[model samples]
Target: MHVKDVMTTRVVRISPDNSVRQAARMMFDNNVSGVPVVDDQGQLVGIISEGDLIRRTELCSGTPSPADTGLAPDEIAAAYVKRCSWRVGDAMTPDPVSIDEDASVTRAARIMHERGIKRLPVLRNGELVGIISRWDLLQAVLSARQDDLPAGDDAIRRSVLARLGDNTGLEGLNVTATVSDGIVHLWGNVETAGCRRAARLLAENVRGVRGVVEHFPDPYPR
Candidate 1:
């Protein structure tokens, strides 16, 4: 499914001019770990997380001793920006990673995994539309499973094939599918681990799929 289907539209954002204390309070009151930092025109410029706030000098005894950091003079100057920064723009990570709202949730998951980020801002035409977090993806998985499978095993099988075929990686893969009593059985050969995961997620995302059993044999040896 697309990010728009699962992303949270009621996003809380902070301005670049806002104070770190204000940003921290906003996150605490909203119970979020991070927030998008926007410009005066509401354009996304950066992100401020709990990690950023916790590193502030006010919370960490003003500044680290030169001996403690052992940093070069230039490095020390750069570190000072982080230590002394009180405004969101100064402390926030600039040019943060973002995703299009119409992109697949799998793509979102992959980006978050590669970046080691907790959340992603969903944008459309260069404007913030919503936000998706690890929690939101988890919720999507749980909710997708709870949905009732479509009536008839044939219908289920067709749906499974359709979903897999929709993915370009699985488009030419030799995949077979069968469904009985809402449980899907997938037997296939894929070129890569990503394709294997693609097959599984495609099946799992289909409504009325109670369970999926994959028997995919990878062609490449580890």
Candidate 2:
């Protein structure tokens, strides 16, 4: 399955103007590592991860002052007590690595591997629609193990359609599906590139789908 197939739709978000403390609090309360940053009009602007926050702390104190050049690293870190106030624009990784909803899961995995990112932003028409993580892909693998796995492409097609029906989110997805070997092929239309990806993730979660190949119509408005 692809990143879109397994990504959660109920995404947590933060505004670019939101304080770092506020973003950190949201992550803490939601038990998430980061959030997508948006604008007043709800556009995907950037992403802030736990790693970014940690980097803030490191940079805030890790810088060696002229007077502290002789100090040990631990002592320097200890002496650098106050966190420098920063904006989302300052702390965020702008234009993060992302996937279109209509790309293959293999491609998403490959991009993540190449970029060394743990999660990928699912984009639709150049907007942040959702995020997918390593955990989501792992879940796709586990979800495919239940029941008697389909033995061939036709059976896999039937199994995938059944899953789309079962997944109401995917049921509303305007896409067609085909199968070859164990891979599911997706075509048709969606509201956004994000929805396309969501459709694929749904297919991945089905018990018989080994992988997904998405080639959907561009849902972006001209």
Candidate 3:
């Protein structure tokens, strides 16, 4: 699926001129963790997340003085900005990671994971069009899963074992399958990637099977 299929189009965005306090209030009111900061042209410029607001001077006291930390002037200045900045332009993370609206869901997932971020701003023609969150991706997966009919455990076990024995051509392989609550647990050793994929496919295609749990052994080093 594409990001556009799952992204929330009615995004809550803020201008760079907005106060940090106002941004935090918006996030709390909307129950969102972050908000994209936009320019006058409505182009995405940055993002202010909860992480950005957590260190505000208003929230905490007893911070070490710049002299006590023995930090360089530049480092001290940067710290002061993070603690004292009130506007989104100064407090937000600039040039935040974003994905195209037409990008694949897999791409969005990868980017979010690699960056340790929970959301991705979806852009079209360099304009913020939507936002995709981890929750949205999970919902898409669950929705797809709901379309599959549940198969009986006994039927799943028998059919999956049969397919593995006949179709996989993994001679002398000892693959066993057990099913409970429509989930198949496959345990075995496969010599090749194709064999592993075939085994999973067989189990997944079986009627009444809700999911596959593979417990294949680690392959010995060649």
Which predicted model would earn the best TM-score? Answer: 1
* lDDT for model 1: 0.85
Per-residue CA lDDT of model 3 for 10-125, tens digit only, reads 99999999999999999999999999999999999999999988877787663744443888878888777867888889889899999999999978998898899999999999
After TM-score superposition, what is the CA distance of residue 48 in candidate 3 from its true location, in Å?
0.5
Better of 2 and 3 by TM-score: 3
Q: Which stretches of candidate 1 lie over 4 Å from their true place?
A: 65-72, 145-222
- lDDT string for model 2 (1-92, tens) is 55677887778898877788888899999999978888887677888888778755545565535666788877666445323445666677
Off by over 4 Å in 3: 62-71, 145-222
Give the per-residue Cα lDDT of candidate 2 at 178. Answer: 89
Q: What's the lDDT of the predicted structure labeled candidate 3?
A: 0.85
A best-first ranking of the candidates according to their TM-score comes to 1, 3, 2
lDDT of 1 by residue, 121-183 (tens): 999887888999999999988887444555568988887876665544887677989898888
TM-score of 3: 0.66
List the global CA lDDT of all models: 0.85, 0.74, 0.85
In candidate 2, position 202 carries an lDDT of 70
- How far out, in Å, is residue 159 in model 1? 7.7
- Candidate 2 segments exceeding 4 Å error: 57-83, 145-222
